[model samples]
Target: MDLKRRMQECDEFFRLPELAHLVPQRRRAALEQLEQTGGYLQTAEEILIGAKLAWRNHARCVGRKHWRSLKLLDARRVRSARDLAEVCWQHLQMATNGGAIQSMITVGPPRQPDGREFHIINSQLIRYAGYRNGDGTVIGDAANIRLTEFATELGWRGAGTPFDILPLLISTPDEPIQWFDIPPELAREVELEHPEFDWFAELGLRWHALPAVSNMNLEVGGMTYPLAPFNGWYLGAEIGARNLSDTNRYNMLPLIAEMMCLDTGSERNLWRDQALVELNRAVLYSFRRAGVYIVDHHTVAKQFCDHVKREEAEGRACPTDWTWINPPISSGLTPTFHRYYDPPDLDIRPNFVRRDFSGDGGI
Candidate 1:
């Protein structure tokens, strides 16, 4: 993007109506530099606003009800690989907040004028390794095989479990990509167990406490931050319906059906649906009993509808991607499914943009 357009986006974010009360006064020199050279978020208030705006403008996310409450941690001073790893570890702990997850993002240094950017190769802060067998069967999470291979190429050692957090792979301009092991305590996870099914605990399914997506490039005006890892509390369906039940991921629906004694002999039995209910039940039950923050699809869908109403009241279009607004399981049941959403912004500013991970194509 051109520098002038980027500066205007930064200015618009600074002047957003939701943050009207909290907006800080800008300095004369900074304002001059913003117009002439380029804009950069200077104050804590500006940083916070930028991060919040990014979340609010994320068209594909249905969890933007807490966008205004995102905690911004400025880690722009983290220059070395060690410091970057430490900052990420700290971010995990802070976001987890002992089961009461906090909506948070840690901002790394912005993109340089020459287009150099810092990036983490892992898709999420925590994910499992997938080892594919000869006959196209995966031993672990099938969705993670490509990333697992990447980590293995980087000399990472997995624990050979259903769930394993990937190591941090950070790359910058001058330095070759460096991999760092995530601190054990930082990646807190919960073992899946059902309230009714005794065999559920025996399956030994586990998932990370927070889904901190680490790869997206965060743009705040003209400066694009390449290593901003951000997270929201998980939705029950994301864990149960998609992650565990999907064929390309854990592919546990068939196992779950067999365990439940559901008729999976034919497609007419609706076996997948029955199994999904149990899986979702286990996830919701486990998170509640473990005192972790998790939202069910029905409740969050209603909350998202309310968010849309509020945004409409404020004369702001609730731009949303319907495919994402609808949950993986029971698409017809959620409130978000019935209604049409406003078209998303073509160029959403102060947002996280996709980045190229392999062979240094700058964002």
Candidate 2:
């Protein structure tokens, strides 16, 4: 976890405005005392600092320009299944913000001596239920088939649609996975409709307002927090090009092309390309109509370039993942595709690290 280096990072961070009180004494002694007792972020303000740094260090996210504005909720005291469920609901409500999405995170308790921590098994707080039939066909979003199967085994049922929100799955130290159905009022979804095509609304396409990633662990200082669910407003292409059009996901491009009456006989005609544009347009239009905060691919790409320029100006090399930084569609058209980044540092702390979920029978 690079304990010494992170303590030094915290030392410098506390030097920022309104934070000098944290390191009034010798930074070394304060760090040693905190590390010795495993109390890295013992206060709400300390956790807020860590959460902001975590967002800043997220290599795959291109929305670092608002890192300092991330809202952090210190839910470290929440332990039981019921409490976890309520917290998840609250996170959705707060992040959704009634259409004005806000970037936020809820830091759960750190890992225990028994190697267990409170966590949600789903990748996102809002995702479709994937149900697999015996003949290999699937219903709903295929991306979550494994989780959907697991949830079904744990007694969860969905409405059998392309946009059903999966129930919250919570696991404690030594208990079965707890299931909680999120209230419909808390999950604000955008109903996608094309501006030019009236038939598009018949597809009943929809998605949750915010993308709250729930499975990643947060590492700050020397402690490994196994359950830190964080969220940010979506980039439109994430839904149009990847989630809704990926062959293994909703696979909507071909259908949309047919509906648009584009020539599907040959790939040279770029039927898929036309469909992709319409899909992306619909996503942006719907979010805008609902007063939600969603950035288009081109805008976010330019913003990412600006973020890197600012970081480099401050004498820091920006680490990034090219595959994630590049939008799923029209990569060559965006400014972000033209640049190279420093090699990623896999050992960086105060970053979201995926936890291994194998052999977790205790749920």
Candidate 3:
């Protein structure tokens, strides 16, 4: 969350040889732009809003398809990490053609976050820097087709059943850049290694020359559940990219991750404990590449929950009723205490209470 500190770390990290020489001025410019653009945290916050929308959409679709089953929808469409990287690369290329230089943003630990860290890069400014060959034949188109072929060959699938290809299709190259091409050796490898390459070869389409650009937002969340305190903590990160090119293209891929520590103190009630368990499992199943850490809830939640009890216990005031109850409820003889409990409020019970983590209203 400390934007300035993280930016400084990023500045130092990018100074390494592999990444440093690639874009020295651009890197400095990005750092300066990050400062002038209101720092990493602020920019990340804005991107989070968009990522949430994307996450919600993905969640809804997955829920609709397999909410009944405990098993999550498989993301075979996004199967390999390489597939994601390629999509990101195309998106960056698209942004470049739009006359906007791309900026990379990272957040979390001095190294990497335990949960998820969202990233957003400018896609409109970085130019495609045209792909060329030693022989002078354009290679951008060849590269694009090869990327898609590689993805197909990998049998990649996104999260969910029958994994919606829409995200990938939209995220893939969107424009036709005559200059962007792939190398012959790489193209040959695709043809040799992937059986699907036969289809491309038969179609007479240079499988390696297909253009790709991705302009999609990503939202990933991670959480940990503790049994003792009977509560859960969550961390979320998100990023959005817009492909400016007609063919989906990206120059670089952003790597993201997150971590969460859960408190489980007030878990006396079996139902509450069950809720916490389900919540944790759900989050794990939903987000890949997320790390979770658990803590004793009783130690943490004791500081938060007023009362913790098992279902058998009676005379225990519902925590929600007390927390939000505007006027003290009074029995008719006393004053009519129960009437103040809104119908909705009466229906809803606090099975679990959070302790350690906080952000965006516990979505």
- Scored by TM-score, the top model is 1
Candidate 3's C-alpha runs over 4 A off are 39-363
Candidate-wise lDDT, in order: 0.82, 0.82, 0.25
Give the alpha carbon lDDT tens digit for every residue of 280-314 in model 3: 33322332222222122222232222222321153
* Cα distance off (Å), candidate 3, residue 80: 26
- Residues 250-329, candidate 2, lDDT per residue (tens digit)? 89999999999999999999999999999999999999997888999899999889998998998876788888888988
User: Which residue pairs of candidate 1 clash?
Assistant: none
Question: Cα deviation of 331 in candidate 2 (Å)?
Answer: 1.1
Lowest summed lDDT window (length 10), candidate 1: 22-31
Off by over 4 Å in 2: 1-21, 24-41, 360-363
lDDT of 1 by residue, 167-265 (tens): 887887778888888888888888899999999999999888899998788776446788889999999999999999888899999998899999899
Tell me how many clashing residue pairs each candidate has. Answer: 0, 0, 83
